[model samples]
Target: MPVPRRLFRAPSRSLLARLAALIALLVGALLVWTLSTVYEQRKLMHRHQAERELQTIGRLQAQAVADWRTSRLADANALTDDSLFAQAVARWQSAPQTEHEATAFVQERLRILQERARYSVVSFVAPDGTVSMGNSSKTVPDAEKKALAHAIESAAPAIVEPRRAPFFAFPFFSLMAPIFDGTRPLGAVWLVMDVRTSLYPLLSPWPTASETAESVLVQAQGKDALLLTPLRRHGELETPTVVSASDTARPLVQAVAGARGLLYGRDDRNTPVIAVVNAIAESPWLLVSEIEVNEAFGEAATRELWVLSLPVSAAVLIAALLLGGWQWRARLRESALKDKLAQNMQWLESAQKAALVGYYVYERSGDTFTLSPMASELFGLTPEAPVARTQWLAQVHPADRAQVLAGLDEALRERKPLRMQYRLVDGSQERWVDMWGEHDAPSANARMTGTVQDITERQRAEEKLGQYRTALEALVRQDPMTGVANRRALTEALTVEWQRAARIQAPLSVLMIDVDHFKAFNDRYGHLAGDECLRKVAKALARTVARATDLVARYGGEEFAVLLPATGRAEAQAIAEKLRLAVRKLAIVHAASGVATVVTVSIGVATAQTKTAMRSEELGRAGAQANAERESLHLIHQADQALYAAKEGGRDAVVAQAEAPSSTALVGSGAAPDPTVSPPPPRST
Candidate 1:
């Protein structure tokens, strides 16, 4: 078989060549337009990615605080009643705390909390600002305490210690929240967690010059910024010479004030950098990434064009007449690849935008770079800006200049991406942002690429979760109707108190309350009215267990239970007697049990301490047994029988149960003990 000979020959005329040239020119123009469009789209995508990264880092930090609060709420029975903050605050307000007492408390708490957290530092503080318990390597300064006091006195409701912990030797920062007594401010509970741990999850990427990239957390306070470098920004390279910290922070502040994010540049040791400046939630923090742009996009992008142009030129000359066909094929394939990339990039950008993300690229060659939609929006610039480098930095936050410069110098030398968080005073409002990216030494100059994101919602969510958690805990530990400890609640409280009593050798007391003839009262009045009567009875019990360590809970259908820490049987009996009278005074109507015209109650008291050989559970059971042995299931079960002795011997009275063999036995008719008032066996709620 023979290959078909070329069919058409170029017409022997100059006009034919001219016509072909025109078509070639048109194709070339189209190529440029299409390629430029693809590149532009890529820029937008980069911007969005940067922003998303920032938001993620911010959220992670915020969630950490929320988790801490949740852990505190888990022990609802012990934690809610004698809130440490509430107690400490009251003590501090009432009088100067004895240094010995304050120190001992903090030290004890510290030893107990010696358990290290993988991501945070936990500790307790005294009213006089003494560090009682913590293992954090970083030190808290007195100035910080003053600042905390000011913030506590300001707008903060319950939010204390609102900033990230600073890296040791880099910067010192942390926050504290004051405890409260209703509306009164108490001593603060401090939280100390390093910012690096919070940012690592977000700025893990951004390749380096020699595989080196750095990240920094910029703290913007007024015209000053404290740059927290994850690693030395410029390894072996001395910190860059900068005018002042304001130079780095001011531009970002202005950008945020304008509500426009900024993607600009600076020359750190003559190495070009592209920075994406953004605000964190409500904190005074900013996230800035200095990207090594040239190595990242310059050669790669231009090299792609170089390879493509050469092949097309060769094809054009090799088969002049078929040149158009060949070029068209190449152009189409290339366009498709570019289009796919652009589309994927678009998707990434959209996802980020919906997530409040932005991206950027830096040109190490000291020329220009591109930013995505989010980045453009960050700086209030059109996507058509020629050079998004130093020209735009004029609007940076003055407060963050020093911090920003330090971060840049470190990033370039270390050849690593940097992650930073800071607050910017944009116009009148403060905006927060987080950023990260790396350096590229391969581009002849240093550069980096990274992302940023906004996390206002996440910050707010964490704060709200704390308040919600408190409410949930309260629901679990309190009686829904009377705001007293429910039966289950009292049991748990006793368990904890027993352990504490053993440790301190203190006494713990229990009071068992029963409404006399409650069943008859319910039967006479409708169940609805009976509920009200029970509620009134519960209120009486609540008042009896009013101490900080006391627990009052619904014991049963018509009874309530009280656990009083540090109280003996004598004290418990006294309190119980008061409760009995308070209930009798209600004068609730009871048409059923013809014996009495009003509702009354009976109570049993028991006391035990760590010094006792018997377990709290056993002691409680014995008290129940005594009540059962001495009384019937009716109001006078024990009290009624004794009262009957007092009343039939009198009327309306108080009584105690004598010893018995069985658990929770009742004193009723000698006819085998009228089985109704036996105390129920224990079980966990």
Candidate 2:
């Protein structure tokens, strides 16, 4: 028993027990460290993912808002460039009392635009910012007066920022387009839009399904940040939806402060949120896309809990092995991805260079451009330097500068895709360049992205082709010997005049002239003399019908036709008589002539008094045009019948048919009737 006391107090057993306790403690510590590292890394990864998603959404919403602003400006610009609308506005402004027609026209146009364009109100504002005419009400709110004045004073289009007006329950904005009569400022076209109907919906939708995710637009006002859009998550905003701009912790305030990119901040509700801030291009507003922090980190929290519950020793060992293996694999994967990315980048660069196409990003706010190597080369600039707006414009040829700037202005104003071909001055050489540009999302900066290609050779080829086409068209429409319109050209002219006469309820006249004895003259003097005689007759007829609107054409062999728009029967007949005299006055000797000793022509005249107005429903219809064309052919038929009558009655005479031939004819003096020819049949009414 005494010996057992010594064995019971074994030091080896005590030492083993202490060692075991130390090992357990070390394992516990390692597990704690590993769990902490894993949890932090997981949270960071989740937060980064959320930030990326939020940023993407923010950019997209910012782009949508910018596009909306641009579209409104475009709508205004459309009216500004419309000459008809401008003339109406001018007349209404200058003589509102006497110009009832102009007033009605302006009102109707404004009404149609309001209804079709889905605007709350479309109004014409006076230069003094007074509502002169409108679709709904002629009231210019005090809030919008400043913007209207700016638009008119600058003689430019402008956007009124969103604000709650006394007349509207919800926030509203205006698009003002100034109207100018030549260099004189007339007024502006004001378009009012209810933000709830037009813009709020753009920010309402979230790309992914999330309960707390929402997009908002913010604008800085003095020392406050005003909420431009209603808070989608928190429901309708209260009056004076603004927060202190000094509150940098608030996402809206941060957005207004021009802080872009992802950040951790509290929302208006004081709830912690992860948000991405972006500025809307060409506007004072900023877009913030946010989600509750709790929701974004929920999955990471659950994973952390599971890791914490694992047995300390086993979990620590497993984590170490997994970490090592993951790091190894991640390195390999990253290396492979880097190589692939390099290869893809090389391919893209080579393709761009080979195609002679270069891309550029334009910072609209900064008035600067960042060009790729190819783009820089195309612009004849150093590749390393960013191009300024002025420098970029200077690269454009002088002849094309205004056009290019105008196009760029329109593109930026509308956020629309642009395609233009213009000449560029590169060094001492001028080269033609075709450029295509499109709007990129206005995230961090307002920008335009596009490609430019050297198209000098292509433009030259197209110009040459156009010249050839013009020459061919001339050959097709003109007679080679007479240098006057041919039969095909005459037919086209007749159809066009007939339609015009029908539209305007005007009179149309046709004169058909024929050489009395061309066949006999040709037989006696040969083809060369016949040709010369025809040329003379054609020249005389062309000279006789001297009005710019009138057309004289070689109808066929030895025959000519004249088209007189807005001419009555009396004038037509007089012109026909003059043409006959003009030809006979040439006095070309024709030994075989029966009508006179000299060459003479018989003329038939027919007039169409289109006094009947076309029905309103028939306008702009293809079938109606076809019918008009048919009526024109009938007119030609009437002229031909009169020509036959003139030939039959006697050579070298003029026969006119307003509807149907009433008299025999007006025969030439010293002309004998051809006994062999008979009177022609009556023409159809």
Candidate 3:
């Protein structure tokens, strides 16, 4: 009866239970709204981050492609500027009878270069669109010939568009540079490199480790975007894949139209992707880096869900315990916020460390410095250690200390922003740092605050760039084979010395020396041995001319020239005799030589008294400067005439042509040249 009565009375709801139910409903609604807001914000943030990373990768790939093309063009230009090649071309152009020999020489050179540079083909294109000389037997295409003509007309190097070669059916591109004889265009030298092997590989590598990320190149073709390089994911598709310009959904189409920055578009596969585009400098190509949108954002969504769930669960637990533990709950919430703040600070510090950056505050009046933890670590000091101005200065590299100090003083006096780069030596280690600081208006107790970033990598890159510049200059001025000054360098030195001689009224002497029976020597020992012999001769000549002002250069094949400033005919003749003897001392055997059993030289010395105006016509003409330059050429002609005279008077002798002396005179006239002084055993041809 009692149980029946209690069940019928029904359970009366407790105040706590009703309040708990209401609280639960409110908390659930709040969590739903907050999670939605957080998810959207997180989604936007992830998208922005992906866009930034892709943009950076796109820009880097574009720069790399541009640099690669630039380097190839530079190589072609350098080859065209070769003195030996120019002289050979001049000889062939002036006298068609020498075509056979000149063609053989040029073909040999092209073959060597092709092997060294790994080119598909290298050709010398004549003005009439004929292949004068080439490494490959393949005929030059009409399109390539027209491009070469354009390059010759432009008087600069040109890069042709990629095309498939008929012979190998492989993709290739041409680099052409006009060959010049002073102001006259002497055809063009062109190189064909396989794009599949040389260029496509450079653009295919993605900077990111993610498999979904890739880089591609696109060029505008009519009203469509043409894929210039292969896609990493879809390797089966042939390059130059065409996409309509109206396809705004395609990143490549947008890129071809010069659209840059992050964009949402579909890839070739029609899959949604996040892409960044950058235009290649100096070319009508665009570099695109893209990642599948789903792949890029999947993890972000997962992380966002977890983050939202964690806060919701924590809030529900707090609400459940609110009735009996309100004070404890409040403390917990405060502590949680503090922990979050601390976590954010920790994250900021981590980011700064990763970027190799640090912050600092300098008190000018106290001459003391306060460094952030990262800054202290960069200086190889404990974070807790007090930093003094003197202590900081002591860490600076000895070589850079003066500049750093002066820069700081200037910045303080001017009350302006300061930017400086210097090296820091901590113990045995050295690091490069870029410091940027700004001070407020000058006052008795002004403070300077700014950031310091470690730029060691940038410094290394700059040093490497400087090294490359030095190497390029060496390629321009130094002979590749003999490691001496090239003809171009010789010409420049001659012009400079001529002007200097005119100013100082000093004599300028030139020695034009030729290796006797060099052709016979090459035929006897083969071209490889011939090259070795030339190197030896060049070394001997370089050793003979040790003065700082003296220059020894490879003028042409089997020929060398030396420039001597402030030297009279007598001194020049003595130097020429010394050079002749030096080559003889090498004892390179030559049985075919009529001059000597060993290698010998014919030397012609010419001395000009630049103080006096030798040509009256040059003195009166308005273009006297031009005529004076022509007089320098006249001096070279006089030296050349003497060279022929030396060869005429048998080899291994020095002939001098000077203003005061007769037209030509042989040096060491009394003695006959030694033939077997130190001759090697001759090999029969």
**Best-performing candidate as measured by TM-score:** 3
Please give the TM-score that candidate 1 achieves against the real structure.
0.37
Clashes of 1: 111
Give per-residue CA lDDT, model 1, range 402-492, as digits (tens).
7866786687666777888655445766556667777655555756778766655555555565565555456556656666676456655
Residue 223 in candidate 2 has what lDDT?
63
The prediction achieving the highest lDDT against the true structure is 2
- What ranges in model 1 sit over 4 Å off? 1-355, 360-434, 442-445, 458-470, 593-596, 612-685
- Local accuracy of candidate 3 as per-residue lDDT tens digits, 1-685: 3566645754333554555457555755655565666567656856766665566556666766886676577678777667777777777778867588886667766765675466877777776666744354334677777777778778777777775546447778787777888777887777888887777866665544587788877788986888776678777336447889888789888877767888889986889999988887888878888899988887877776675566556555555555344234557544544554454455456545655778888889888888888898887765645578888998899999999999999988888899999999968888999899988546778999998888786677557645755555566578778999987688777776665555445667889898888878878888899899989999999988857778999876777899887787887888888899889999989998988899999998888864343332434443444544655666776787688799889878999875533221111111232233322222121
Off by more than 4 A, model 2: 1-12, 97-101, 132-139, 237-239, 313-685
The candidate with the higher TM-score, 1 or 2, is 2
TM-score for each predicted model, relative to the true structure: 0.37, 0.44, 0.55
Please give the lDDT score for candidate 2: 0.75
Each model's lDDT = 0.50, 0.75, 0.73
Rank by TM-score, highest first.
Answer: 3, 2, 1
Span of ten consecutive residues with least summed lDDT in model 2: 661-670
Worst 10 residues of 1 by lDDT: 659-668
**Clash number for model 3?**
0
